[model samples]
Target: MKTLLFCMLGLGLTACGSSPKNAHSNQDELAMLVGTYTNGSSKGIYTFRFNQETGTAVPLSSAALPNPSYLVPSENGKFVYAVSEMNNSTAALSSFSFDKETGELRLLNTVPTLGADPCYVATNGREVLTANYSGGTMSVFPLQKDGTLAPADTLFQGEATGPDTIRQATPHIHCTVFSPDRKYIFATDFSADRILRFVVHPNNPIPQTSPEAVDIEADSGPRHLTFSPDGKFAYLITELSGKVIAFSYNDGRLKQIQTITADTVAARGSADIHLSPDGKYLYASNRLKEDGIAIFAVNPENGTLAKVGYQPTGIHPRNFNITPNGKYLLAACRDSNVIQVYKRNEVTGLLEDTHQDIVVDMPVCIQFGNYSARTKDTKN
Candidate 1:
């Protein structure tokens, strides 16, 4: 019955009268793991189960850790990597072996990030990368074959600073992400106002850091980045200036092409950026003063963005994710301790609140994966 409803919806027949509960019947159970700051009622990381067909979710299980502020699962889904967002002279990245079926996690190992206040983590199935905010460096850890993280392999430290007196007094590496093709890595430095590019060398332990860095507008604190599905374009969100910049990506380099403000009335605390799976739209979050998501329509021809609209959200939307099926958007409101779920309109690229909020204290990151209800042992 759910399969038939899904087929009808795919055929553009809304009159088929399919209910939300049956929307995801054709797909496997959608599992989401949320990372949160530990200062509130939250302990560490929490898991939630959802029906993609119904666009709804409920909390499942949680594991205790210290300041698990950022998380990224391995490419094969066998492991989850998280960063201890601390600033007591040093920070660490912890590894966990994930059990997809039961939504459980076991601690594998933890290694010093060789820096202070590590904020972001990314991997290419072999190496784990982290961005240290206070230390102004990027830490690299090699992932062992058995889901553990090796000791620090390298630390790429930045020496530059931007024009902002208070915020840009020193370097602050905000995010570390890889190109979809896995050929390059991009690290955004907020205080330096630059995005450093590196060529991925799977054979060598460390990446070959490029000498040329992409410099954004002087005071724009480049925070996070997302690449278009086609890999021809990339979008960057600046935290200090509340702006989004569109760039042309090719051969391990970025060239800025366009710039736009995320919100004129909001404080400059732009946090995260992600593109729709279909590559038709881009979404960015605004924090601090105005809590909302600013939407933009992607121009397929020129890799540019046009402001479409904005949806107000809970306080401090630190991170968010668009469902793989492109039917929903989930925003993790850090300050409000709730995850706001919204239904996505594919045709217009707009969002409408579903009013299905998953309450978890100080939620900072949200990621989606698939799990098997039958076997509970399905890999990835």
Candidate 2:
């Protein structure tokens, strides 16, 4: 996979250009884009105007589609890619051209994943990757010159079983991630209890996989992953066991260093993990049981986690995001159909609910667009 900004630079496209003196300043207020499951009253993808200083959100616009469960925006915020998490014949990936000033999403194109329920999608700015959860495969799509993704040209499948017979009967790739340096790819193969690694081939669609980075705990069902700002650390949240595993990462090599449970990891549904922008705190979201956010303090001397606090959230907190300035945290509570906003206390590494909920239908993914993101890897 590759970068859209860099890709545009390579193709000599000027749409990626910025204003006066060629500067892209992150405005105080930016567009908040949410992806939702259409099983209920949800319309698909929605947008909001988010104020970074006040920690408040106001509804802006919405896009109608099927289950656009996960979304990944381009580095320049000019485009977004989302997964249509559906079955066999209907499952696909859609690309949208985003208007940063207006926060409007115009459909660019759609491509079949060839696999069912691609719950996760990732890109390195060159190619797009999808982790087909139901079909148990990893599919690849090259990026077109105009920002639309090319047709699915390659598919990766692994056959293995973990300790859990019911959930791990076959390979279930949940998330695909690129190394911080963007040289390699790492995938959380949930059913296999292993993190798969692949070497980037620049323009190649066929994956050249290396040895899996690390094997997860038996039946852990690793779901999502996040890296520290320095890229020296990586954190993974396991859905089945609801545990958070910390790792020391280098050159695409990840070493498991610590593992901690947030009261309930055994089938409680640990969904997403993220770190504060300052790299002081790490937060993990859980579902099915307490349905809250687990806050932990990160050790700077050595990458590890110590449980600090927990903030209860709405019904099924699927995916969440911390503001780039690290002033607030937002949780996409899917079942409750609302996005919960919480203020973060930097000193104690804790969260306080502000009672600010952006009501929507089954909001599963929350991402900030139309803003100059702090320089970091494109994490989803």
What TM-score against the true fold does each predicted structure earn? 0.90, 0.89
> In candidate 1, what are the lDDT values of residues 151-260, reduced to their tens digit?
98888887557888888888899998989788888999788888988888869858885445888888898999999999999999999899999999887878889999
Candidate 2 lDDT, tens digit per residue, 1-380?
11112112322222222222123235666677889999876678877667776666555556777899998887777789999999776899999987766667999999999989988888777889999998888888988867898998877775567787777887788888888888888888888887888888766755695445588788788888888999999999988888899999888888999999964635458899999999999999988888899999999989989999899999999999988788999999998877888899989989988776666778899898746344243322
lDDT of each: 0.82, 0.80
Which candidate number has the best TM-score? 1
Q: For residue 323, what is the lDDT in candidate 1? A: 85
- What TM-score, to 2 decimals, does candidate 1 have? 0.90
| Candidate 1 pairs with clashing backbones | 23-53, 24-53, 101-376
Instruction: Flag regions of model 2 displaced more than 4 Å.
Output: 1-26, 203-205, 209-213, 263-265, 370-380
